[model samples]
Target: MNPVFKEFKEFVNKGNVIELAVGVVIGGAFGKIVTSLVNDIIMPPIGALDRTDLSGLFISLNGTFYQTIKQAKDAGAPTLNYGLFLNSILDFLIVSASIFLLTRAFIRFQKRQVEAENADKICPYCISKISINAIRCPQCTSILEETH
Candidate 1:
């Protein structure tokens, strides 16, 4: 086998690469959801306010006026589509916010689990709840072993 192929094989076998592949697949699906939210949900209200479809909103600098975006593109007219840019920005913001919220919730859940585990420490003889660092079991008066 070529040295490059050997290195590639090692890279593909790594846990991080597998995790990243899974993340990419999930992110792609998440992106489509965000795109739909931006295109269907968010833009519709904005379009109603502006009295024009966001996808149709554009400015052609040339004297030639286009009835539609396709016509403008076919005519090779220079144009600025601010509405599309706005939609893209909204999509990015929505995706970022969702990922941020999910990560925060996961962190909070992990912290709660850790706290619950800590609360389970008990005096061996008395069966009463006790701090992990207790020198002796307060209820039973038994010596505590150093866990560390």
Candidate 2:
């Protein structure tokens, strides 16, 4: 194999690298789902309630009136698309909240796993931490009798 190809294979074979690639793919798909949710499900009722089309709300800088953003852009007019900006901001907030919740859940799970592995008892011989279910002190190799 070519040196560059061999190096690339090794890099791709790493577990974390594969996991990261899967995460990026899933994140991109999640973004599209959120975007569709915002545009289709959330925005219509919101726009109706506000008595304004959220996506169409923009200020024409060229002093030309246009019914839609497409018309304005097609006419070669500059516009401040604050409505699109607002939509993007909403998308960012949703994604951020989702990532935060996922991270929090992952942390809680890790804590549970650690707790199951490490316990409150200190081994008398070595003064090292051991699991509640342990039959022996791992550090000192001292046999233990269940107090309970």
Candidate 3:
């Protein structure tokens, strides 16, 4: 095989490349779900209670009062959609919090794994970490008790 292809194969075999790609795909789908939750489910009740549509909440630059964004756009007027900006801010906060929680959980899991691996015995004489299965301390060459 070619050297470049061999190196590429090694890189792909490292596992994280595929996982990262999958994460990206899943993250995109999650973003869509959050967007739908905010726009379709969460905003409707708030809009109803306030007696106004959240999506249409905007300010027209043409100094004309419009009931909805549709009216402003129909008149060829530019608008500042502060409501949409607020929605985007909410989405960002939700995603960041979720990612932070996931990262914390992953770190905790990694620490548990490290502690499990460190369950090996420590040599009494030299105080060096040794395998639990060791019959003698490899560092100090001291005899160790048997497992029976």
| Top TM-score prediction, candidate number | 2
Candidate 1 lDDT, 8-113, residue by residue in tens: 9998986499899899999999999899988988888988997878778788869788887778889999888877887888899999999999999999999999
> RMSD, each candidate, Å?
4.8, 4.5, 6.1
**Cα distance off (Å), candidate 2, residue 40:** 1.7
Pairs with backbone N, CA or C atoms under 3 Å apart (clashes), candidate 2: none
lDDT per residue (tens digit) for residues 38-146 in model 3: 8888888988897876667799998999988888989999999998888898788888888899999999999999988877988889999888889999999999987
Candidate 3 has what TM-score?
Answer: 0.68
lDDT of 2: 0.88
Colliding pairs, model 1:
none
Pairs with steric clashes in candidate 3: none
- For model 3, the superposed segments whose C-alpha errors exceed 4 Å read 1-17, 48-52, 122-148
TM-score of candidate 1 to 2 decimals: 0.75
Off by over 4 Å in 2: 120-148
Candidate 2 lDDT tens digits, 1-148: 8999989888888548978989999999999998998899888899889798777889999999999999999999999999999999989988899899999999999999887665567777788877777789988899988864
Least lDDT summed over 10 consecutive residues: which range in candidate 1? 116-125
Q: Which stretches of candidate 1 lie over 4 Å from their true place?
A: 122-148
Backbone collision tally, model 1: 0
